[model samples]
Target: MRLHFLGANKQVTGSRYRLEAAGLNILIDCGMFQERPFLKRNWNDPPFPPESIDFLLLTHAHLDHVGLVPRLVSQGFNKPIITVEPSVDLAEIVMLDAARIQEEDAQYKAKRHQKEGRRPKHTASPLYTVNDAKKALPLFRGVKFREPVQLNDQVTVTFREAGHILGSAFLEIAVKQNNATRRIVFSGDLGQWSTPLINDPTPLDTADCVVMESTYGDRSHKDAGTIEEQLANIITDTTQRGGNVVIPTFAVERAQELIYYMGKLIESQRIPTLPVYLDSPMAINVTELFHRYCRYLNEESRCNFEQRQTPDLKFPSLRLARTAKESIAINNIKGTNIILSSSGMCTGGRIKHHLRRDITNPNATILFVGYQAQGTLGRQIVNGDPEVRIHGRHWPVKAKIAQIFGMSAHGDRDDLLHWLTAAKQPPKQLFLTHGEEDAATALAATIKEKLGLKVTVPDYEQTIDLT
Candidate 1:
């Protein structure tokens, strides 16, 4: 068997891996490079021919894991794209939104370049169109959690709950050859334990080789209860000061989680009821999915919805902004209303417009409830840059910037270690990916010192033999 690390080797986004086993060529995650320095990779041709891939295994519907599949399909890939059921629904929404954004961006850039009378260095065209994304949708094959799906006579794959998001999972594959079976696991963005809405990450006792994510390998998140407390304090303080709380949210898990917490706070009388607007159509659609997949949610959230008839994410003060006019109307609201918009990293979306307005308002609180990758606008704000360019104009940074670290969907250092140590037997080799260099390196050292296991942090396009 052989494994290839095509992307997300020493970076946080763009996660692609190729595995060859039992005469089958399988691809895992065909993600987009989101950081500014690596955005060029999104336009590059696949290192291997797209048609050569036989199957695409998706762990979740996060853009970083499923964003580039449409482009891959447009390049001649026609294969089965397998993932959990909820991810199937979520991926369709994410890809279509991504294609629309790309097409709009391309048109905007072309017009700007023409007006300036300057030829652009790069092609002012979309990487893929909405039609391309649509063609890729028919290939998806949704499977239930923990169900084993046979790839061929010699290999079988299983999906297990990752507890990261609605339908996130870690993959387990078994390959039989020469009267022996070899096991491999791919840890796809593990989540924290005892978090609301979702169950804890499922643990596996054994594997021969493993590839894991190290997104937060260097630190620990604050306790979950503390996250709500900090969120309440920030919103309450901002409201008392007659300012809004503008949050850059991820459409999938982060947005729903924030809404749930805000609902709880209001119900408990911990924070005064204020207008809470979900300002992105995509996030609004995703919130509705929470109701459809209530069974996938944790017992408390599920019971609260089914038995109490009170959705944890709904309250009298909450509003869904689904149209451009509705989104614009939010800016005119008098005071202290909370707005949640996407994309979470502020790479693109209505969040930028919100930020452009509130980042300069002294009483406003710009809250971040998700991870911020480097070279993105969100990172620039979080890093305390005095002035930032948005829509080609510089804006002063006067707002109170706050982040709730415990709200991250990705597990932290201690969580990762606990997941590993719980395994009945350590894998012969462990490969870490999906993190910046410092985080991966820190995790490697800690694993070596504590577990005495052989670990490797592969580079982009690196290939290794699995013995």
Candidate 2:
């Protein structure tokens, strides 16, 4: 078997991995690159010819992990793609959102090039369109958690509960090649243990080779109890000062979690009883999907799910704003109300407007509850940048910014070790992906010291053959 590391090998963005075995080709996580310079270089760096690939297996629907779906379809990849239901629903929004951003960016780049008086050989265009996104949707083949489905005579894929999001899974692929069977495990962004709204990540019995994410490989999440108190305190302080609070959340799980937390905090009287608004259309859609998948909830959240099964699932002060006009209207009538929005990293959406409005006022607070990549507006805020440019204008940062790390979706180093040690025998080679250099390095060292396994981090475009 030949394993190829195309994207998200050394750095954490575009994640494309190809495995060639037994006269079959499988592509995993055909994602788009994010961040400034990397996004520019990777989105257009001529993708591998789509025809050569036989199938695409998606690992959840975060934009950085599934953003290139429409592009792959547009580029001639007509193949069966497999994903869970929530990931399928969420990927549709992710692809369309990415297309809109790319088109908008392309327009700006073209105008600048024209002004420079150099007719470049190429003009920028969107990576894909809304229509392409729609075209890619029908090809998704849904698989249930912990069920083994045979792809062909020689290969069977089983998905385990990954605890990351609603439908996230840890995929184990068993392949029969050269008259022998080999099993490979892909820990697709292992989630933090005991997160609300989903089941926890179940470890595999064993595997011949393992590919895992190292997103938080160097750090541990804060205690959920302590972080909950911190969140309550932040909101109380802001509302006491008569200012609104803005949260930039991922349109999927993060938004739902924030909503749940708001409900708990509001009901517990830990914070003011102000109205809470969900301002992202995509998030609204995903939340509806969550309502549909109540059976998948964890033990604690399932109780809340049963409560929401009542007709009036909404609490007294929760508002789901799904219209652009409704979102814009927030600026008009605002007190100490809390607005949760997307994209989580503050890269786009109504969150930008919320930030530009509330950031200049010292009374408001911005609560960050997830990992912020380098070069994102969320990271800048978390890192205390005095001023930031948004929508071509500079805004002074006066809002109180606080981060609650316990709510992160990804697991910490301890969780990773726990997951790895559960295997009967250590993996033949542990390859870390989807992390920064430092985090990956620390994780690799820890794996060596604790588990005493031979591990290596693959560089971009590197390939390793398992013979």
Which candidate has the highest lDDT of all?
Answer: 1
- lDDT of the candidates, in the order given: 0.91, 0.81
Q: How far is candidate 1 from the true structure (C-alpha RMSD, Å)?
A: 1.3
Task: Write down the lDDT that model 1 would get.
Answer: 0.91
Tally clashing residue pairs in candidate 2: 0
lDDT string for model 2 (75-188, tens) is 788899988766777787778776766676567667766777867434366667678888988888887877788888999888888889888877788998778879888888
TM-score leader:
1
TM-scores for the candidates: 0.98, 0.93
Model 1 Cα lDDT, one tens digit per residue, 188-259: 899999888998999866799999999999988955558778998999999898999999999999999999
Q: Where does candidate 1 stray beyond 4 Å? A: 121-123, 223-225
TM-score of 1: 0.98
